[model samples]
Target chain A: MAIVAQTSRFSKIAWPVVAWIVGLIFFFPIFYMVMTSFKTDADAVNPEFLFSFTPTLENYANMTDNYDYWRFATNSIITSVFATLFALVVGVPCAYSMAFSPTRSTKDILMWMLSTKMLPAAAVLYPMTFLTKNVLGVFDTHFLVIVVLCLINLPIVVWMLFTYFKDIPKDIIEAGQMDGLNTWGEIKEILIPLAWGGIVSTALLTFIFCWNEAYWTVRLTTIDAATLSKLIEGNRAPEGLFFGRLSAVSTAAVGPIIVLGWFCQKQLVQGLTFGAVK
Target chain B: MANRTIPRILQTPAVILLLIWMLVPLSLTLFYSFIRYVLNSTVRPEWMTPSFSNWRGFGNYEFVLNSKDFWFAVKNSIFIVTSILTLTVVLGVLIAVLINRSFPGRGIVRVLLISPFFVMPAVNAVLWINMLLDPVLGLQGIAVNNINTLIGGLQDAPIVGWFFNMWPVFEPISFRATQTSSIAVIMMVTWQWTPFAVLIFMTSLQSEDQQQKEAAILDGASRWSQFRFLTLPHLGRPMAIVVMIQAIFHLSLYAEIEIVSRGNGNKNLPYLIGEFANNNIGAASATGIFAVILANIVAIFLLRMVGKTLME
Candidate 1:
């Protein structure tokens, strides 16, 4: 009995230490990037100043002169904001109907929506470019980026809303109906208020997805509508020359999203797995 | 009757929008795949325009099939996805179990661990390739140089000099090389995705039946046996979900491959298709179709699993 207790005591201390070590190791790159951003370009590469150097704000101050950081950042904000709002606008009602009034075919329809998401974006790259650039003449436009981002994220948005809506008991909606509320009134007055938290998280997750989206955003945009993703991709091979400024911009690009991600960590499993795991 | 009409009216816009989004570009891709189209062809200006007269039928598919890059991309795609899936699931299960119990600073650990998942893929790739993994000035190079210098200094010491002399000079690997680019991509993506798997598994772990575990302990079951019997079975569903979700995402990885080596040594299907789309429209479309077919194979199973839990 004493031996068992001793072993358990040993494990208790050993395991948490291991866990802390692992967490720090995983976070070291981001920590290093943030640390590097305060150094000058020369100090960033010089081994003599690797850990001990006079930190400066030059990288953040010169961010615009070096990379035109604000323009791409503004574009990222514009596209991701509009895309999240549009997805909520389109997704809310569809999820509302499916959750409340699901038909025999509703399950199949939901599955079909998810299946559309599975179709590789690479498969239609040229066609989308052809149609957008030639047929519609909207390539590299913010409108085009907004529409594409909205469409790519709509399925997940709807799926998340559906799962959230499913949890709100039918009696609440029925009671609202008995109050002589119209269909729109039931949704606006009853459903949205009851599901406000879910709706907000769904929007948050969708916005994060849009912000981090690299494939279509990079492919579809040039100078006019390029987001931070495109800006980073453009400077992919800096040849280690501008590590300080590059790290600063990169940190700026992802900093807010990482903070936002912490709040939605719980919702993420439901959002990404379509609630199948939980 | 009124009830049904209102719901249908509410759903029409979303349905139609998605239908158009899926069908239009895909059908265009299908049409282009059968024709010999090119962006700029001075010798055959007629072939530059996509029309039925330029129809190549299976010729484009045959051409893509015959290319060495297509096969390499397929093999590399499979290698990358499987490696990431394997590493993330294993690490995820272990980490989730580690932090599952109440710890002093568990919340901070989770936040730190999950931060990587939110880093944009472009930045993830660039941060890794240039700042973290670069052989000359990156952390890898610095660390390697420090170790070599330490060994050099220790070699001159009195008694332990012979042991230190036997150690060869440490060399930092250049991850941008043709042979190591894929490994670099796998490392970065695994870092980004393991947190995702951990979050999912931890959520599942919270719902695990503690009564069964206590019962096993009462039955004198060892820690290994208890984990094997109760926890592993409980985690099976989430593990499967993680694998399928990650498979769908990583199979079409583009930004990482592009930024890593610029498709120098690690071209996946999406990267290959991007290359073809530069001028060879027909081949690009055909390759795109192949990518769709591959994605669908995985999608079928995922949809099946998600569908089972839909109405429930």
Candidate 2:
């Protein structure tokens, strides 16, 4: 009894300290970025200013002159929002059908939809460039970016909503059926209210994915629809000369998305794992 | 009959959209892989455009197969993926188990931990390369210089002077070099993805059978044994899911590789393809096809597992 009590006493003090230390270590890079953003370019690399330096907002102030931060940011916001909306519009109905009234091939269709995601974007870049640039004539436009984002994210949207909707009792939907309600009415009233949290998480997560979607966003656009990802990658501190402004721009690009990510961290598992883990 | 038709009609839009999205470009890649094509050709300019008459049967594939970069890319891809898998899983399991129990500031801990996973890969690569890993100006450089200075000061002390004099000056490693660039990528990517693995494993840990764990404890199983025998087995499926998901995602890791070293010596399959796409359209398409085959092999196992459990 004494030994057990002593071990418990030891663990009570040790565990939280260890956990706090681990958390801080993981968060240090973000802290460093935010801290570096407050310095001038000269102070950014100076070892003497590592801990003690006059903090300045000059980096944030000169963001427009330096990188045209707002143009790319607005593009990112426009594309990500519209893409999320479009995906939800298409995904909700498909997932609803699969969940409430799954046929024999519903499972196969879901699997096949997921397989499309595994088709690498790099493999198809040339064809997409050729089609969009020459044939479609919509290259580097917001509409093209929105459509591409929506298509890539549709499968995960359907899969996440299906998992959420699967948990609702089938009898509830059938109860609406016995009441003579039409299909749209049943979904609007019975299905959606029960799965509202699921729907919101799916949207939020999708928006996050669209925001952080560096690959397609960077490759597809040139100037008009170039996102914050493109802006940051295009100006990667040539010779480490502009670390201060670069950090400011990067922090601005990802800060909102990171905070947004915190709210949907719980749903990331179902979304990324194809609802398989839970 | 009406209900069935409605569901089918509703699903048709999504299905058709995905079908077009998947088929159009892939077929183009497949077609181009067989033909002779280049974006710019000063000599034999007729071959510049993609056409059936210029089909070089398996010539592109042969060139890709024999190139030293292709083989290096294949080996480097395997190495990066395998190293990340090992690191994320091990670190993920440890961190997941550590925080599984209720503790102070758990919410804050989780919030801090998950922040890294959301950073844009472009930002991640740039941040690591410039602010964190640069030899002369990064935090790494500053820390090394500080340590050497401190050791130099110690070398002046009376008793520890001899001990400090024996210690060599610390030299910071430049991560943009050929040999160590891949290690830099592995570090940054592991930093980004370890949180993802933790999230999955933590979710799986919540569903772990508490009663089974208690029984093992009552049977006098030590902590290590209990975790090894019970927790590890219970997490098998989630671990597999994490591994496969990461495999699919990291196989196409381009932004990091592009920003960090520009494939200085750390070229993976995707980077290799990007390099080829500069002028050699045929070779790039063929390599893209090879990447597709590699991704599909992993995707098949994952889809099978997911399909089985999905219906259940």
- Quick one: best lDDT, which candidate? 1
- List the candidates' TM-scores in order: 0.98, 0.97
Model 2 lDDT per residue over A38-137, tens place: 9999999888889789999999999999999999999999999999999999998899899888898999899999999999789988888889999999
Could you report the DockQ of all the candidates, in the order they appear? 0.72, 0.69
TM-score of chain B of each: 0.98, 0.97
TM-score, chain A, candidate 1: 0.97
For candidate 1, give the lDDT of residue B54: 97
lDDT (tens digit, per residue) of candidate 1 on A142-229: 9999999999999999999999999999989999998999988999999999999999999999999999999999999999999999
In model 1 chain A, where is the ten-residue run with the lowest total lDDT? Answer: A1-10
Best by TM-score: 1
lDDT of each: 0.93, 0.91
- Tens-digit lDDT track of model 1 for B34-88: 9999999889999988999999989999999999999999999999999999999
True lDDT of residue B286, candidate 1: 97
Q: What are the RMSDs of all candidates, in order?
A: 1.6, 1.6
**Which portions of model 2 show Cα errors greater than 4 Å?**
A1-7, B263-265
